[model samples]
Target: MEPATPLMNDETETLSRMTPVEAFLATPASNVRSETPQDPEHQYLWRCFPDHVWSQRVRDTSSWVWDFGYDIQNLNGSRRWVCKRCIQNKSPRPRSFAEKGIQNANAHLFKGHGIWAPAEATKSAAQRKAEKMKTKDQRSIADVMKLDTRLPREQEIANSLVKSFDRKHFQRLLLEWIIEENHSFSICEQGRLRQIFEYLNPLVKITDASITRKTIRHRILSAYESHKGKVIAALKQSSGLIHVSFDGWKSGNRHSLYGIACFFRDENSQPRKLVLGVPELRTRHFGHNIAAEILDVLDAYGIQDRIGYFTLDNTESNNKAMEVIGGELGFVGSTRRGRCFGHTLNLSAKALLFGHNVEAFEEQRSDQLTYLLRSIQRSEFEMSSDPRIKARKPLDLIIDNDTRWLSQLYMIRRALTLRPFVEQLVLKHRQQWEQDNRSRRTGNLRKSAKEPQICLEENQLTTNDWDVLDHLARLLGFYEDAVKTLEGDGQQRRRKRGWVGSYGNVWEVIQGFEFLLEVLEDYKKLASEIPDAEHFRININLGWEKLNKYYSRLDETPIYYTALALHPAFRWGYFENEWKDNAEWVTKAKQMVREVWEREYRHLQIVRNSVADEPVAKRQRKYYNPFQAYCERTRTVSGCIVVGGWGQ
Candidate 1:
């Protein structure tokens, strides 16, 4: 490409060539004055050259001119010049010196920057020698490996390195590092990390000592105190009657009686179970005194006024206690007292078997059966490994002292079911006992010597004991009859098949047995005419009457009646056996009950509604303002108010 011409020869030359006297008229139409050339070609060339070629040339010359004071330009159709003085003053432009300084200063930072370094003789002899010395001073990977290989010889070094770190301290350090690096950790993440550290670190043990427990307890107390304000606020917002269920039970040691009060909302939409009170009952206190102490607990929880009913197991002391409380609270009749269903069932069972000679027999048979079974168990254990005898412990062995009688009954029933096994056990024990007696007489010690000595005395199996066993068998048969009766009596097969009828049978069986006991007591004289003879039965008719009266009264109670009506075991028969027999009477009774309940409920509602509306109605008076009423109630005498002004 041909060299381009200069747009301007020089600043001085261009200025001198211009006519100074001519008016310098600058207009948007033309960039030049009238005296200067305004050719379209020249104007276009000037604009293009300045934007493209002239701008590039100026940029290229700027660094050398500004820094080194040297400038050079092309010499062709365009006039250009170079400054020799500027070039000479630049001192060889310092290319080699600047490069060497930068490389040396950045050596540590840039050593690994390049993909590869030149292997040519670019370095001076002194630089090469210095580099060699630096490499010699530094340890190589092979040298370090050799040094590590010598570590086994230093016992002290190994001991120092093996010193165990305190896990908690290390964990703290790690947490601090994490916090320092990340600024903050979320509560959940912090807890997770804490658990992880606790699991992994041996030295950071979780202390559950008494001191820790006390500390936790104190913290909980503090939290509860903090929440007390909120709890009170919630209580104020809630409306309705609060019902409380209070129960007291003696602890295993009987040293203290603990009372638990559960609060709940009643059918009238009231909150309950808000407070639980526990008080220690002294052993010296009477039943009435214990009841008073319970009242004291109620007072402490601010629950005395809210209590509507008290449910308890059937105990004389409890009933007396309830009587005392009722008198104090002015609650008449049975309004404040209710009996537990579980306790009533037990009482019913006791009542049904009243005046029975079966109880003594049951006790005797139970004792005999226990004695026999335990002897067999001991013998079985001793001869368990004997090759000739396949010894096994009876599944129905009675071990618990408290339930021994029940266990005896269970074992007898089981023996009846597994007749072969029981027969085997009995025969085995009998044979072992015979062998033991023979050995004892002969003065021969046997491996099964730990076995209990069986009593062959005939007096041990008395008439009373046999009578009890026979009665128990009869009771079982009665139970089966009761079940069959229920199954056959119901209107529908499905309904008849339920447990309700059986419960009725259970009640009937108990009453029938009591009646039988009465008959047995009356027929003592006739026992002489019977095949078997025994001791004359003592007249315990008074005891039976008392027992029968106690149970009958219990059955008459409203709570027992309610339970009998509601119990799943009696639901089918309750409407049929009890209510259906007297349907007309029941219908009248139900109508009367409904009328009483409706009247009572309506009266309660009226009272409540009256209480709610009184304040509202009073406030509706012309001069009465609710704000003023509030102020009056709060006893605030002065506040901003408008008087005698309708607009205000």
Candidate 2:
């Protein structure tokens, strides 16, 4: 049977003359040809005539069905119109609106979507006006047109959707708002909040249950699964090597979570950073245990063999982890390990603050902090009469985070600024202590009324201590700026000196080490001349030693020199100018970089085809090299040759 002819000229002309079955109009013939080639952005708007049979894709203006749905064939592989609103809002979503008729689509839209056709809306217009007259915002269409500034086309589409409430879209926006603002999980569970939502839409829970904590959690997890799949697929498609940066952190609940984040050039050649996983660490955090955890994640993503570099905090155990991974994965551990630049600077900062055994000093300070801070806040030992102490700055003290250098700087700086208040606090505590002793000796103090006197001896900041801290904060500021430059946050000014790309890569490490070393050396030499600063000469020397140790360790990896040499911005010229005085160091750096080049790139001499020239394939059959894997993943090798003594 043929599709019913379109009644475009007058849809209602035959309404009075035709039967109810014949009232449905046919899908447009031009649409049959036009809809096959879909717009990339609007691919959901399809008109399918599968098997050359009409599935009743009616385009009747009188029936407002198409406004709230999409052609299901293109949307989700169903050859029918499906309600998009229902799918977004409903927990157990309806698949399609209708396959052979408009009546089902009409019923679903009106019931599930709370949408009314123009004819039905017209019938209830008087009743709707009586129930609630259009408030202060309503005006005549003529008056609205006089003030309307939108283009005619924009105005038409806006007016059509102005009354149409998309419950799913609203719910999604609300969920995002709640999550972004860190709102409580039971925000939507309140009785009043649910009532407000019911009055606002009247269809918030029509197709699904109320949005409870369970619903929110489920939705968030579902989104996580969806995004995880996309990230895995993107990683697979990425031709570049995947570099991973991971660290272990503890939550408030004391749960140890090892967070693994990956960085790689995506399929579009865009740099992408994403957290791959945060697996719980139940076992003791040993080098071998950390390696096993990282290996599990890499194996799950199937990128274990493609590992490029591991950037981790500088620690004995972490270094051991690199060795373990290298032995198992067949790579040079020394060349692949990248000491986190921030942690390198932080070690120097720690050396400057705490002379030696930084951990021991910091741990003891932490234990004393509880009682020390409480004594400072006591009413009888209140610091000063000056309002500035209480009004300006935060009332609490700043504690240093062992991993972050800036925290130590902030702690020292805050202590220096609040010195006067601290002095007054010491005086108050001393007076209170003397009074308590007198009362105890005279037998005038009641046993029930007595309380232990708080002490502030260990916590007092001295004049000499302030002088040392003042200098410490100033010097640590230089390291803070270097950290910013390495993290790519210094891009707003002139292009970062050591950085080459959008985000800082391996190329920035060497130059950053040089800049920070210069600052430390300059300060170390001046420590002898400065008054009250002689006490910290030992601190400045300790910082210098710690920083120089890492600078010297740069030799263990050939990548540092290689990345610096290959950068398009400078190449070997940067090292030539910077290391003009150190000719020996320059020569050694050049030799290391050249070895990598000859071993990887320059060894493969391409020949079009002498019978069949494919050195990459030939090498794969004979033995394995990491260069061969890169060539296979990122480039096609049609011809190649390898000569003896390539590196030599």
Candidate 3:
């Protein structure tokens, strides 16, 4: 049964004669009051009774009143005063006065006047029943009336959102929502979403026009066109050179998508990057077609000539695209296509690890290991019934794919971790195979047990092989760091395009190639020193050949040496120290760098007479520009020593 309203009042008063406060405090007790409740504790109503009349301030009647009865005094002070009836019934959401004292009581009296007012002053039972019967639309109108009854900031934000719910804003919001949350367009038509929106904000109505899947698609198309126009406009206005990258990949649905992104520094030198578009390839992705698509995009932005770099993977298709575009752009020679350093490192590592094979040898062993593990699981299940005998989990072997060598690295690492376990597993399989053969000879096993046993010959891992695997894992760890540092997540290309940073610049590659050769040679020497090297013939010379091929190509690219010479830290002196054995190559490198200054940058020079009124020390300022000073020579008198520096 519903609990009785203990403090119900029958007094009646007109709104004009008395306020809600007066009517609320003047309420009388319930008609069927408990006759045994004659004590002061039971009769006390903190909201209605004066504090002074009940007890002294020193005795802390406020604490007793908050606890509903004065029998027990709280050691810790109390703030909110629970309703006497609510406390008695043990309501989870008990009505309580605020910590600020009587302000909450006044608010309660005003807001709850519909139910708390005297019998005659309150709404009639018929009127109350009519309120409960109101439709959702009618209730929504009532909720709209209370929109401005919130905190200032909250109310302002809500009002702004409602006002800005125009077609464009709605389209942009819907597009972002769908893409970011990976939700389908059909979600707009779903009932649960509409219900949730209504429950969250009754005043805001989500109409069919705003939520229909067809309308959402149309809006997305229009928004895309609008955004594309803006991007084109910005690119046309930009003065800085723009670098672009394009890559094609198949999605989960088998759609061929080609994504292109542009990077450049803004007018203030702040880095900025934006995706041009990810257009789907409906037609065949031929070299000419890809070139045409890329040119169309660059031409649309009017930034074809301002293109700084084309960061693409070293693929024949992409190379053809570069060749076709290069003819039109007047960019000749081997430097037309800026090969992605990350991709180059990936290819080099793959060549080193798996030379001619399409897939790594480790992958085949991994498959065999996986199959044997499954067989072991079936064999061990019957013995796993005992709680103490914990079932062994099947080992997860990593697949070594050709494209990503990092997966190969992780596979080798996992192999090292499971080396001991795998060795024991292989031994067990061999013994079980022998035992099955003996049982079959005796003709004691069932026909089902005559299944083909796992051949351990395919799994070519032994204790000796573990040492080689360990070496490979340790060696690949360096390349893994290089790839991560160069590629950086591939999201922030503008920031990662710095010269001296780990982002793998053309100049850094020259140094890295030299360093990598030394590392490989050192490993080769170490391998020769290992005992039983003949048994484990780990040939790393193939890696050296591949690395040297790329290093030789670096000689054809002058920018690499030019960049190294330009850096203040590593000038001609650094090469002298680093490449002492190859003095002729160093001389050729310096000559090529000097030719760059003479060929393209000679027009920037300004001649000055040094004998004017300056002192010997200060005269060095005449040829202060390093590029000019380094390239030009000074003719000093034969008798006098060349007192000043090279510039003087």
Best model per lDDT: 2
lDDT of 1 by residue, 1-648 (tens): 224333333323433532221101100011122323444333433332332222113234222112211121223323222222212223222111121132331221112111111233133344456458746755432243233535565544433433554433453455456445753333213556556654563223221101122222233344555775654444444444333445566555464665655444334333334444455665554668767777766654555555555656566677777778767766542544655433443333233333344355332234555556666655666766775455545555423122222333444455454444444555666665667556655666565655443344452444454554444444434333322332233222223222122122222322333343344354544545534433322223333453355444443323333333333444323334434567664344334334434543436644343234332222222213332222223221332132222102
- Clash pairs of candidate 1? 263-272, 263-273, 264-272, 264-273, 265-270, 265-272, 352-510, 500-569
Model 3 agreement with the true structure over 1-648: per-residue lDDT tens digits: 224355313223432334332333334334232435433324433323334122223444332123232222123443344454443323334466634453344334334322233334344454345345643435422245455535787577666755654544544575689878978777876888767765654533532123555445545655677788788777766655688889999876577888989877665444567888776665688877788778767776778888766778767788678777877776652554566665666666666677656354543454555776666655665467775444555556666765574677888898786666566667776666557666555755554554333443644665556787788787777666555544644343333223222233445556566656766787888788766654323446766776777677666557678777665445565566567889887878877777766754567657553465733342233432322232222222232221222112
**TM-score of each prediction:** 0.38, 0.57, 0.57
Q: Candidate 3: lDDT of 332?
A: 51
Error of 2 at 455 (Å): 6.9
| Model 2 lDDT per residue over 1-648, tens place | 234345454434424433221222111122222333434212322222222232334455344465445554433433566565543333234446444565677665544433444433332334344235424334433243343526787566445544464655766887897899978767867889877875564444332224555456556766876787778788899865898888998876577889998888877556778788877776788988988888878877888877888888887888888888888888877778888888888888888778788767643243344444445555423465776544443345677776555688888777776566566655765565557656555756544544333344555556667776777888887777667656653122323242135466677687777766776788877787777676588888888889889989888888898887666554666676677799788779878877777765576667553453633332223213322222233221322121242112
Q: Report how far residue 34 has shifted in candidate 3, in Å.
A: 93
- How much is 35 displaced in model 3, in angstroms? 95
Question: What TM-score does structure 3 among the candidates reach?
Answer: 0.57
Models, CA RMSD each:
36.7, 16.2, 26.2
Count of clashing residue pairs in every prediction: 8, 0, 0
